[model samples]
Structure formats: C-alpha cells, structure tokens
Target: MRTRQSVCARKARYASAAVALDAAKVAGLALRPYRCDRCWQFHLTSRTKGKWMPITSLYS
Candidate 1:
C-alpha cells in the first residue's frame, strides 16, 4: 500500500511539471518584440506613451 501511494505521488509531481512546461511554452510565444523610440531591440514595452512622437515645425 505504501509503494502504491508513493507511485501516485510521483505521478502527480510529473503531471504538475508537464503543466508548468506547457504554460511556459505558451507564455514564450505571446512575447512581443518592443519597438522603442530609438528603434532599438533591447527595450521592452514602456508605460509612457508617445515615445516616438517626431519633432516638427519643418512644414514651413
């Protein structure tokens, strides 16, 4: 009976691990490439908007 219980526990652990791996895979795919004002690939999404607003008054 003790061995059966241990086997069941191990199976549960493996199931939880599989679930964690699947979650990570889905999360990885949802990641987007952030486009910064400088157009650098190093920056992620920023909280402040209008980071790319161009300087104007050249329409004269």
Candidate 2:
C-alpha cells in the first residue's frame, strides 16, 4: 500500500473501474477512479463538492 499527502486519499484495486464505482456506491460516497502515475494502479477519490479540506482539520 502507498500513502499520499492528500487527506482524502484511499487506494483500492478492483478488477475494473466499474467494480470500484459499484463499491463506492454501496458505501454511499461519491467517488471516481483514476490511474495512478507512480504505482500504475487504480485509486478511488471522493468527488470534489466543496473547498478542499485536509482530514486533520476535522480533529483540530
């Protein structure tokens, strides 16, 4: 598994992009998959609906 500076980063490998989309729908989160340049794997990220915020900010 790899880590990203972005707080909302979540990585998961599915057989296909459609499968990933289905999983995201089941979780009730709006997500889309893109090919990672470094790892060359698919990663799902939340659709940007508002201003970008770091996950750490929620704790502080």
Candidate 3:
C-alpha cells in the first residue's frame, strides 16, 4: 500500500467503495487489469490532488 500524504479520508473511502462495487459487478475469475482496491485508492488520490492543486494555487 503506497501512502501519499496529500490524500484525504473521504476521497479514499469513496474510491474504495466505488472500486469494490465495480469489482463485484464483474468478479468472476479474471486477473487481467488487476484494478483492485489499492489501485482505485491511488487513482482517486492522484486525481483529486490533480484537481485540487490548480484551484488552490490561484488563491495563494
């Protein structure tokens, strides 16, 4: 599990939940992409960070 300081709790939880739900929809013996919980969390963190930084920089 890669820890990124910029990640927040809410987004991480949401990402995890979404990923789990999606995985359930197609959880039948397959390991191609391997887009599991961790991947989803990392993606969400980076995406959120990407969206947040630019807007925040404007005010500072």
Candidate 4:
C-alpha cells in the first residue's frame, strides 16, 4: 500500500509567526501566514479570503 503525506507535512515549517509572515511578504502580497494545528508551526497559505489585504495598502 502507498501512504499519503498531509498538507502540513509537505509544507515548510517556520519557527515563529513573525518569520513566516516575513517570508510571505518577500514571497508576494498574495501570501499570508497561518498556524498549523498538527505541527504547531507557522506556514504560508496562498488563499485570498478574509483579511487577505495587500501590503502595498499599508505603505500607501
């Protein structure tokens, strides 16, 4: 039988939320940081729902 890895397992793990958010910023304005329940670590999500505001708004 074959095993499947979870989304959390495949994604990169960040030590802190700040680090994750920073990475997201560098990656692009469309990305955001989110806490993974299983890993207890921060990861970036590309979902553009909710408060997915662009960083450019803060500057302008």
Name the candidate that leads on lDDT: 4
Which 10-residue window of candidate 2 scores lowest in summed lDDT? Answer: 1-10
Model 3 TM-score, all chains together: 0.21
The candidate that achieves the highest TM-score relative to the unseen native structure: 4
> Per the 3 Å backbone cut-off, how many clashing residue pairs does candidate 4 have?
0
Cα lDDT, all candidates? 0.33, 0.63, 0.38, 0.75
Error in Å for residue 2 of model 3: 24
* 35 Cα displacement, candidate 4 (Å): 0.6
Q: Candidate 4 clashing pairs? A: none
lDDT of 3 by residue, 3-42 (tens): 4445433432424545644553465532112233443442
Which has the higher TM-score value, candidate number 3 or candidate number 4? 4
Q: Between the candidate structures 2 and 3, which one is better when assessed by lDDT? A: 2
Q: Global lDDT for candidate 2?
A: 0.63
lDDT ranking of the models? 4, 2, 3, 1
User: Number of clashes in model 3?
Assistant: 0
The number of clashing residue pairs in each candidate reads 0, 0, 0, 0
lDDT of 4 by residue, 1-60 (tens): 221248878888899989998887888765677777777788888776566586885575
- CA deviation > 4 Å runs, candidate 3: 1-15, 28-60
Model 4: lDDT of residue 31? 64
RMSD of 1: 19.7
Candidate 2 per-residue C-alpha lDDT over 1-60 given as tens digits, one digit per residue, 9 for 90 to 100: 344535324556665777777887888765766556555566677755664656874565
Write down the TM-score of every candidate: 0.23, 0.51, 0.21, 0.65
